[model samples]
Target: MDWHTLGSTPFLPPLYWRAALKRKITGSTLPEQGLRCRVRINPNDVAAYRKVCGFADSPILPATYPHILAFGLQMQLLTAKDFPFPLLGLVHLSNRIRIHRPLGGVSELTIGVQACNLQPHSKGATFDLLTTAEDSLGLLWEAESRMLCRGVKLEGEALDNPLPTPTQVSELTRWKAPADIGRRYARVSGDYNPIHLSALTAKLFGFPQAIAHGLWNKAHTLAALGEHLPAANIELHVEFNKPVRLPSEVTLYCSAPGSSGELLLKGTGDLQHMVGKWQPIA
Candidate 1:
C-alpha cells in the first residue's frame, strides 16, 4: 500500500473553537487522505511512558506505546476536511489493541490511522478509527478505537456502549489520581488535549473539571496486570464508560478469563469509569 508523510489536518472554523459554540455535531464525512506518518521511536519517551505507567524500563516497547504515539495523527484524521462530527463532544467508547510482537528501542516505525465504519448508537453515532504501526519486518502493533459523537444519532440507534460486565471478577488495588495527572501524562505521551489540563481550561470544553486521559488509564491498567500477560500474541481492549475527573481515587478490577477478560477502573461508586481486557489475538 502507498503511504505518505503526515500533514497538518485541514482546518476549518468548526475545529478552531468547537467549545465556544456548544454546537451539536451534525453530518458524517470521512477523510480522503488517511493519517499516515513515519516515526522513529524515541527511546527517552518510551522510557518515560513506562515510568508513568509504573513499568521497569527495558528495550521492549510497552504494548500501549504505539497507540500513544499514534494518537495525534488519529486526532488529525478525525478533524480532517468535512469531518462529519465535531471533536469536542465526541466520547471514546472503547479500544482494542493488538500487539503482534515487541518493537525494540531502535525501531523506526510507519504509522497509519484512518477513520472507518460509522454506526448508530441510541445516544449518538459511533465510529471506528483504525491505527496501525509497522517496521520493515512486518506489522508491529494495531488498534481499533471506537468514538461516539453525541446528539448525532443515526437511524436504527443501537445499544449504548457500556463497560464490560464479567461473571467472575476480582478487585485489584486502588490509586488516587492527582489533579495534575493529565498534564503529567501529557509530558509522557505528548497528548496535551486541553480538557485534561485544569478546571478553568476544561470548562471551555464542557467538563466540570479536568479529566484523566483515557489512554493513560489503559496503560495504568496494563501495568497493573503485571506478569499476568500472555507470553506472546497479546490483544488488549478497553471501554471508557465515563470520565474520571481529576483528584480522585479509583479501584482496579478484572474478570475471569473465558475468551477475553475484563479490567475495570472504578471510582468510589460501582461505575466502572473504564473497562478493559486482554487475550491472545488468535
Candidate 2:
C-alpha cells in the first residue's frame, strides 16, 4: 500500500468534521467489527522476515515481529473501502506486545482486529485499535495493542528531554549478536521490510548497516529485568530512541527501586541510545 498518498487532503470536509465532533462526544467504536484474517507461515517468508529483522539462525523465531503479519491483516481491514476512518489521518502514538511462546518453523495462525473508542483531542482525534493473533490450537500468541492517531495539528510535540536520565546506572551484561541474525529473525517474524538488514538495503534508509529489530531490544530489556526481578508479570515500555547496528554488542543495564524499575539497553556504537521502562506486574 502506498502510505505516502493515502491521506493527502490536509483538512477534513465540514460534514466530516461535524460527524467527527459527534463521535467525540458519543465515542464511536471502530466501524470494522468481527474482522478476521488468517495466513499460514511459510519458510521462505520467514527467511525474508528474519533477514530483515536481524535475528540469528536459530530453530525458534524471535519473540517479536509476529505483528508484521498480524498488522498486515489489520491493514487490509483498515484500508477496505467500506472501512471507517481515513488512513492518512492516523498517527502512531505507542505500542506494546507480549509474546507467550517462541514460534518455531512454520504454522497456521489467525488474526482478529477491531477498532475501539474514537477520542477527539484539541489537536485532532484519537482512535484506539485492538489486534489479537492465535494459533490453530486456540492458544493466543499475543494480545492487545493500543495505537493513538493524531487528527490534525499545526506542530507536533517537541522533545525537550530527549536524553534519558537513569537514577542509577547498574552493571551491564553484553550479548554478541551474529551478522546473520537479521535473516533468522526475519524468517520467523515475517517482517522482511528490508530496512532492518543488509548494508545496501539499510543505506537506502540512511543506516550504516542493518540494525537489530526494535522487538529484539525489547526482549533484551525483558531479559535484563528478569535477571534482577521476577518475570511473572511485568509492564514493559520501550521507547525506540535509536537503532542498534548489526554485528554489534548491546549492553543491558537496569536499576529498580521498589515496584518501579528503569532499564537502559545501549548499542556500543555511533547510535548509543536504547531505553526501556519496567513496572511490577499488577
lDDT against the true structure, per candidate, is 0.75, 0.54
Show pairs that collide, candidate 1.
29-84
Candidate 2, residues 178-203: lDDT per residue as tens digits?
67666666555433435566878877
Q: What is the overall TM-score of model 1 with all chains considered together? A: 0.86
lDDT of 1 by residue, 1-282 (tens): 234576542233444444344355547655555667777776777877887777666666777888877866766666554577767667877888888776564467888988878787777778888899888887888889898887875777486646546646698678777898899898886666779989998998788999998888887877777666763478888888778899898888886544467677889767668866777897
For candidate 2, the clash count comes to 16
Instruction: Report the number of the highest-TM-score candidate.
Output: 1
Q: lDDT score, residue 232, model 1?
A: 44
- For candidate 1, what is the lDDT? 0.75
Best lDDT goes to which candidate? 1
Per-residue error for 132 in candidate 1, Å, reads: 0.2
